[model samples]
Target: MTAADLALLDEEVTHCRACPRLVEWRERVAREKRAAFRDQTYWGRPVPGFGPADARILILGLAPAAHGANRTGRMFTGDRSGEVLYAALYRAGLATRPVSVSADDDLRLIGTRITAPVKCAPPANKPEPAERDNCAHWLRRELRDLAELKVVVTLGAFAWAAWWMALEPVYGVRPPTPRPRFGHGVVHQMPGLPAVLGSYHVSQQNTFTGRLTPAMLDDVFRQARSLAGEESRG
Candidate 1:
């Protein structure tokens, strides 16, 4: 990502007040845990895109974690979910590092970027339909800005639905009779973007219980890499 792109994203995230409920919840978390993340400014407002702006693969996640991205300002940082996702990305040769703790940490995405459907940490981590719709414009703009984007990796069913809805119009495809169901490692191709891969979200439940193993996640990335015409080191 260019410096300009990063700056713009930062500015938007800092000033984002799209959902008043989210703002209130994040502020409460920030105030309650002030001592925990004193040095790291709580970006409790809204999270933004992270990793390379020129990324060819966009990783779509559901939302920021209350104690994770909400506390650390960077998406997927300071969270178990991010740890699992980053490890898989590193193994697949998509990431320069294995962990994402903070924005200042040295990490890079060669052919990938990670974003969320709802940028803010919602109450109970659930964003209502109106909130998701409100944030769709930003996601659309991000996709539009990535000139080299060829693939999108959606983490969960919600993310998959949002992405599919957002891109269907751009691709001019007739909506599916019964919308495709989400499954781990399922791949779908659209007219505009050749590949859209779906995977179970790397939440604590999946990772801790071995539902989504590292090797399994790596295999998904390997497929994504192949579809994107990128070499997979894993």
Candidate 2:
């Protein structure tokens, strides 16, 4: 598929309101306005994936943050989790910069893309099963369109599961029986499928509690780059 096709899919994603609860929650958060961002306008719509159409590395996240991507209109932007993620990407030579604050920023991904299964921000960062299914087609499209994709670095178990769910239809293969369990630094490889590398979510809850550190995240991306056959630039 061409970049224009991906762009069209992105446009469709932004206009989606298939899940009433997610639509209500995302809109409510936008309207309520977080105290720190009261002066800025909220995107309030479904956020689309970021990066090139031919990306070799795909970073799969759970969903957009209520005040982060929901306010900035870009996946993983304007949030602590984004800070950690982009920084690691930069270290891994996958991004142009170590920070991702806004969609309009000069930040860029190099042979890398980031997206989520659930497009809209959900209440308390939790997306319901029905909502996830509602948003699955978008992810399937993205997977189908990223023709050069070689690796999928899933952030947390939710994204790992979503990766398998989205992959089944795209590749016409079910996940291996017993399924590869999710764990930081875990790797799962199957013929005719992009390798899956698991990582802890870049949330403050993980970072602040000494569960996920810079070195750890960097290592995950290091492995991801290796799996993607990317040369080390860090």
lDDT of 2 by residue, 113-138 (tens): 99999999999899998999989999
Give the backbone clash total of model 1: 1
- Stretches > 4 Å off in candidate 2: 232-234
The number of the candidate with the highest TM-score is 2
lDDT of 1 by residue, 1-234 (tens): 365765576567668788888889988887776566666667676888886767778899999998899888888988899999998999888888999998788888878889998888988879989989888877876776677787888998999998878865555566565777899988887566658899888999888998888888898888888888786433
lDDT of each: 0.82, 0.93
lDDT of 1 at 203: 93
Give the per-residue Cα lDDT of candidate 2 at 218: 85
Off by more than 4 A, model 1: 1-10, 34-40, 169-174, 232-234
Which 10 residues in a row give candidate 2 its minimum summed lDDT? Answer: 225-234
TM-score of each: 0.91, 0.97
What lDDT score goes with residue 47 in model 2?
96
